[model samples]
Target: MASQKPFIAEHIYADAQTGSTPILLIHGFNSNGAQDWDGQQWLAPLKAAGRKIIVVDLPAHGESARVDVPEDATVSKIVATLSEIIDNHGGKADVVGYSLGARLAWALASQRPERVNKLVLGGLSAGDPFAMLDYDAARKFADEGVTPEDEMTAMIASMAMGEGKDSHSLLNLMQGLGREPFDPSVEKPAAPTLLAAGLEDPMAGSVDAIEPFLDNNKTVRVPGDHFSALKSDAFKQETFAFLGIAH
Candidate 1:
């Protein structure tokens, strides 16, 4: 039996400037806020700008580790939980999400528009590649150290077994995420959005895969691959400007 807890591990960075709207930071799949933002030196600028920051460790990731996901834990449920977090903090937050976090953030913008002000999506595709992945394959590799020839499968398996991470919990989380029917074209989130795609990243088809969906987004090309993009200096510069932190 899985714990009924919401698995909300939150950390707050208070602004020196009073009444500043907070920005929510959501990390990618198999990553944590500490490594994604704090460890990567992102929090410094936000803190210096006197903007409150909120970072959450999503289910089965980082500090919110539970081996099994709750039965009722669907994508919608997770979005709603995030909404409540925003509401509790100050209401109407700006969101920044990377990869898996981007997917959830986009859903939040659609389903709970009132909770979001501006959205920033990084390292995202207009598709759900994870759904096509074999969770069993990833799990077997993590549990038994069996490697997969498939690049994506191998990547996921490696991340699942990262330092201090639980492979079983990742399997449970990935299974739940696999059930989500995500089609960005069919269901677009109408919000002021920014897309940070890496030029060398395969996910962006070398700047072609995202062409169809760039209508409303402000796209910026950063130098790096999928993982390295998060820590790119160009990405940080563009992101800071977009988020309205004056140079």
Candidate 2:
């Protein structure tokens, strides 16, 4: 059975306001809330704008490492858990997410449209990349330091085996989520949305497939690749502007 430990969340309330709808920030795969959102300079400015914020560490990542998700977990299952983050607050929020977090946020908004006010999704495309990963090769390479013949497997293995990362847990997470690959057409959100992807990011090259689903949306190209896109000033400014927050 997957461990039922709760996800770790940090709530930062606006100094001058108490009842405003908060913003929920979700980070990408193999990343923590602090490094992804706070470290990227997202928190301070949002606070300055009097926006209450909730930052969460996804299960099996960062502070929530002890929370184990099964190998058969589906996107909807994880989405259900994320919805609790909204429930604990005011039952709804504006969401900002990047990469794998973008996929999850997309699922969250679709699964619970009423819970999302506005959405900012960055570094995302239409499908799940994890679905094509060579799990066996990745596991062997991560466990024994053997080189994986498959390039994608090797790359994912290298990422999972990084310092302070739990390769086994990360692999488990990827395998589970890949069970239900992302398909935007299945369920689309009704919230006003902003989609941003790096100009050189191949991972998000197929973002056009997701555009039609967003009735009220705008798309922007920021400078940087997948890894560096989150830190791009253009991406930050666009996200802040779309959310109506001063940055």
Which regions of candidate 2 are displaced past 4 Å? 1-5, 8-16, 67-69
RMSD of each: 3.0, 2.8
List of clashing residue pairs for candidate 1: none
TM-score of 1: 0.87
| Alpha-carbon TM-score of each model against the true structure | 0.87, 0.91
lDDT of each: 0.79, 0.83
Q: Find the number of clashing residue pairs for candidate 2.
A: 0
Please give the clash total of every predicted structure, in order. 0, 0
What tens-digit string does per-residue lDDT give for candidate 1 at 125-171? 76676667677777778877888778888876677786687777876
Best-performing candidate as measured by TM-score: 2
Deviation in angstroms for 205 in model 1? Answer: 3.2
